[model samples]
Target chain A: MAEIRLEQVRKAYGGVVAVHGVDLTIRDGEFVVFLGPSGCGKSTTLRMIAGLEEVTSGTIRIGARDVTELEPKDRNIAMVFQNYALYPHKTIYDNLAFGLRMRKMDPAEIDVRVKKAARMLGLEDFLARKPKQLSGGQMQRVALGRALVREPDVFLLDEPLSNLDAKLRVRMREEIARLHQDVGTSMVYVTHDQVEAMTLANRIVIMRDGHVQQIGAPLEVYDRPANLFVAGFIGSPEMNLIEGRIEGADFVAGNLRVALPPGVQASGEVVLGIRPEHLALTTEADGVAFTVRVIEQLGAQTLCVGEAGGERMRILVDRVDSWSPGQSVGVRFPAAKLHLFAKSSGQRVETAKP
Target chain B: MSSKATIYGFLFVGLAVTLALIVAPAVYAVSLSFYQMDSFVGAPKWVGFANYVAVLQAPEFWRALLNGAIYALGSIVFQVILGIGFALVLNEAFPGRNLVRGLSILPYLLPTVVVILTFKWMVDGGIGIVTKAVEAMGLPPINWFESPGAAMASTILVSVWMWTPFVTTCFLAALQTVPQSLYEAARVDGTTAVQRFFHITLPMLKPILTVVVLLRAIWMFNKFDVIWLLTRGGPVGATENLAILSYRHAFNLFDIGGGAAIATISFALLSVAVLIYFWVFPLEDD
Candidate 1:
């Protein structure tokens, strides 16, 4: 078990930088997920940590060793790739035992570890079978077992569940969590799916366009996103970001005005942010006017999409009444739930009044 | 019904060409083994298995068969080795890689006669650069074709030089299909470059390698032009293979039945060898 430290790690392909300088330290045994959309350098950063991609600048440390120039094998880290990347020609047993055998471990010990990993992954019956004979989930388990047998200092997974079907992805996600808990080894997972990051990570490092937007606990980032991107990216159905300006302690857009939260300082242009679940249905006179354009019944909660104060907004409510398009209603944005960001910079503005 | 018609139409064309060009000539040759004739239009006498027995009993026939095996095996071994080496070099990322890849296929693109003559020119006793290089290196001037060993070596050398590019191209294409992640996984699995090649690259290439070797073997076994143009089965038939022996018996010696019998035997042997090869290295993985 070792903590990983990335100090100002940068990756550039010619003049096109893939990953801008990223600095973060992963605590020992921590499950840190690098979360981002495609081409956001999350995978590139994970690859650099795995030593599969050469870092353009900065150093990578696993534990106390400066493994910046070391080969991946020498760094004592095992990686599971997006496609599983299991040796197709080899049997499941051989695939699991490959790393151990390469390290010149004892035959008995390698066999023991292979058996244990197979049992852990429920692949004991498939030891002699090649990768093609297995399903997608089984193949990914073999990939995980391959990493498990090595007992490496850290585990790097690059979208390990992306190829699996939805139901299988959930099962594998739980399996990975169980594996991590059982072994207590540090794992660095990369994915574009924020749900996977939120569900699987002890800490989620959210990135955009090669720059890290925020790094915190799943709900910590969900509750308090550092920037506009994180605020929209971390939640389901997205947060409502209404463009407006602050004047006389109220956020005003067109003819609509709402009392701002206390301690608002130096905010002329601001983007009012609130989640769909935070809006409450109230009397039309006491709240912002909302024209319902589409109503989607989401089983327990109904999601209503419409315009509020001349800005498109989504509000979620547990309602039994059937709603249709063109219906006007009033939705109140709770003060504590309202998130405010600087319109020009997209950074969160301090809401506490002096 | 239209798709069915299209499929049948394509199949019929292919079958007609195969039967007319390949099956007919092969059947005619085999049938000639049963007859004794001085010329194609002469009064032919039925010989049955007499020609086969006579050809099989000849020492030159056996020697030619052995020479063919040696030539095919030697050429294939060197071709596969050098082909893989060249392919591995070409597969790496380098400047001018496409230009080098295009240039590498030059020897294979040349006609057989041109390549043979070029080989001859390069090893000529007086004006050859190879001879001059050997002399400059203070090495004994080697006989390229006068001796039996040198003659056989020269034929195999020229064949490998002319055809290694084809094998290299096949291997290079196969190498590209190997997913780069497998190599990266191997690297992370604690493998050096050589280990990765053996563990991942070679296994992934097995199916293609099997087919390529079989093709090169069959073609080299029946090859007549390169040896004929270079040595002409000379130096007391040192480089003579089954094809050369069959040609000599039919054209030079006018033993048509004997030539046909030799050709028939070579065909049967090759079919048996191919059967054995498939049995040993089946293409489909279990």
Candidate 2:
């Protein structure tokens, strides 16, 4: 196992820049997920680390060796592509044994290791089957088996589960997380799906455009995002960001003003972010009244869509509550749960904990 | 008769005439092969397989069969291999690629008569540029059309030159179908360039390669025009193939039965190839 480090890594294709000056350090045996919107350069960053892409101008270190100039083989990294690129002509055994065969490992040893990997991936029965004959989930496991048999210093996965159905994706996600636990090898996974990032990663790196938005523990970034983009990107329903202004010590969005705690420095133009689940409907003082637009009943929980003042919002209301469209209701969330950021730059404005 | 009945009667008459124009000739030739020269007015004597036996035993017919096999083997192999090599080079990003591709097709697109005439001019006696170049290089000048061996070699060369680009076009289109991601995947797995070509590119091209090779083989086997212009079954029948042999027997020999017999044999050879093709690459399970 080895720690991977990137120092000001910049990748540009002719005139277009894909990854702009990224600096990150992934610890030994750490499961780091690079999560972002599509074309956000997170996959590019991961590929650069795996030595699949050259650093336009930067250095990458795996353990103590600077592997920036080395080939992918010399870098001792294994990568699973998005489409599970198992060799279509080769059997599952050959697919898993390909990297080892290139190294000319002992045949018996290769057999043992390949079988062990197959056993772990539940693909022992499929060793003789071709990739085309396998299901999407089985092919995904074969891809994982190919990576596992390598025993590399770092494992890189590029949206490995995007091809599978929802249930299969969940199963594969857990299988991957468990594989990491057993192998104890450092991993860098890239995906646009934030839920996968939250469930599987020890630390998540959020990106937008060509810049790194934030990097921290999944829960830590959720609780305290470094910027508005990170906060909006890390959550599923996507954090609701409304344009607002700093009026005296409070931030005001249209008719709603969130009164700031004492001694808090306010920016001129700011944006307010609050998770839908954090906001609740209650007949309490300081709660805002909203007109219901739509009620989506999700069995035990209901997702209510409404307009608070002129701002449209979706709230996750617990328990079965009947609320018709155009009905007036009061909604409130803890004041500290509200996230504040500068409107121009979208940088988070630090605030006291709730 | 009703209007519809009249139209139907006219359509049947037209269909009969079209069939007579195309299908009647083959049937007439086969029937003629069985009859001897005695039936010039009514129906000739029924020889029954004697013509087939005589044509099969002829030395000229056997030589033509041998020449036909060599031509098909030589031209198809050279065309496919060279065509694929050129297509691979063209598939890459390079300066002047469009110009190179356009220039490469010049030989394939040239008319058969023009190609044959150019070769003939380049290899004519001592005045020919090729003959002169051979003499200058201290090599004996080849009697291209006079010597059976030399004539066959030249015919093969011209045929390959004329058809190679056609095979290249098929290969180029097939090469485009190989997904770029497969190559990337192989690269990441430490597969060398050669390994990637063999293991990935080659397998992906199997279905297309089979089609190109089979079609080229069939077409090259029946080729005649260029060989006729270049050698005309030269110096002891060195360059005679089945097509040329059949034409000569029908015209020069004035033996329609013999000509039809040779044509039947040629047809049998092609039919055998088609059968083997089906056996070797049957739809999917194979």
What is the per-residue lDDT of model 2 for residues B1-286, given as tens digits with 9 covering 90 to 100? 6999999999999989988996798778777777664323544677889989998888888888889999889988899889889899988989999999889888887899999888888888958899899999999878777766777789889988899999888888889977776787777788889988898888877787888888888888888887788878776788888989988877787766777778877878898988999799764531
Q: Poorest 10 consecutive residues of model 2 chain A by lDDT?
A: A257-266
Error of 2 at B241 (Å): 1.2
Error of 2 at A250 (Å): 1.9
Per-residue lDDT of model 1, residues A1-354, tens digit only: 899999999999999999999999999999999999999999999999999999999999999999999999999999999988989899989999999899999999999999999999999999999999999999999999999999999999999999999999999999999999999999999999989999999999999999999999999899889899999899998998888899988988887687877777746889989899999998788887899998888889899999887788899999636678998898897888888899889998866531
What is the alpha-carbon RMSD of candidate 1 to the true structure? Answer: 1.5
lDDT, each prediction: 0.93, 0.86
lDDT of 2 at B210: 86
DockQ of every candidate: 0.76, 0.50
Give lDDT for model 2. Answer: 0.86
Candidate 1 residue lDDT tens string, B204-284: 889989999999999999999999999988789899999999999999899899999999999999999999999999988
